[model samples]
Target: MDQPQNNPKAYWRENLRYLILLLTLWFLVSFGAGILFKEELNAIKIGGFGLGFWFAQQGAIYVFVVLIFVYVRLMNKLDRKYGYDEEA
Candidate 1:
């Protein structure tokens, strides 16, 4: 509460950075592997399914779930860094 306005701005900037990075990663994994590199990835199979097809079907969703957890963890750390209190 004692921090200046610029301090919160810095915190918001950092938050956006995290979001951009994570979202980009998700997009690349989902769109790249599933669509762009499908044929190449098909060479590698997983549980009788082509890697690319797996990604197109279920892998992206799994990745999204993991990313959700990662985001939550990152946000928790970021909140602590910015001295944010959930109860407040």
Candidate 2:
């Protein structure tokens, strides 16, 4: 019987795709909102603080935490799809 082969390259490609996407979102939230769009965001107020200020101080951290969870969830799914899950 021929054993099935696992393609590490494909798995790594998918992993990289998820990493790039999540990192891009983190960068956008941290740098784009905090700096590039700060002037525009400052026009809006969030809890008596400028939107930019909030993003620079608190929002970025919140987004990073959420991203961490998202990455875990996505990687879990990926692992299952690739038959690499420990449960298997």
Candidate 3:
């Protein structure tokens, strides 16, 4: 539900901003670090596995899972801000 006093455009704009920022970060970690900068990242090792290899294999998945939680938190905050949140 939307409030008459709330500016829908502004709320949507902010939502889009968060989406873009988070998606861009995901892209950088998944594609940029896993592929584009793989050689450089490979120099660093975690658990004896190259960082690049880790990112390509597991890091991206972890980041995505974290991002899901972050998105949920962000949306909850946004909903409250806009008075669109439901009583839970």
lDDT of 2: 0.90
TM-score of 1: 0.88
Per-residue C-alpha lDDT of model 1 across residues 34-88, encoded as one tens digit per residue: 9999999999999998999999999889999999999999988777777784743
Candidate 2 per-residue lDDT over residues 1-88, each given as its tens digit: 2432356788899999999999999999999999889989999998899999999999999999999999999999888777788988
Model 2 RMSD, rounded to 1 decimal = 2.8
For every candidate, C-alpha RMSD to the true structure in Å: 2.8, 2.8, 3.1
| Candidate number achieving the greatest TM-score relative to the actual structure | 2
Q: Judge candidate 3 at residue 86 and give its lDDT.
A: 90
Stretches of candidate 3 off by over 4 Å are 1-5
Q: Name the TM-score of candidate 2.
A: 0.92
Clashing pairs in 2: none
Poorest stretch of ten by lDDT in candidate 1: 1-10
- Candidate number of the best lDDT: 2
Question: Whose TM-score is higher: candidate 1's or candidate 3's?
Answer: 3
Give per-residue CA lDDT, model 3, range 1-88, as digits (tens): 5543357887898899999999999999999999999989999999998999999999999999999999999999888787678962
Q: Which is the better candidate, 1 or 2, if ranked by TM-score?
A: 2
lDDT scores for all predictions?
Answer: 0.88, 0.90, 0.90
Model 1: pairs clashing at backbone N, Cα or C within 3 Å: none
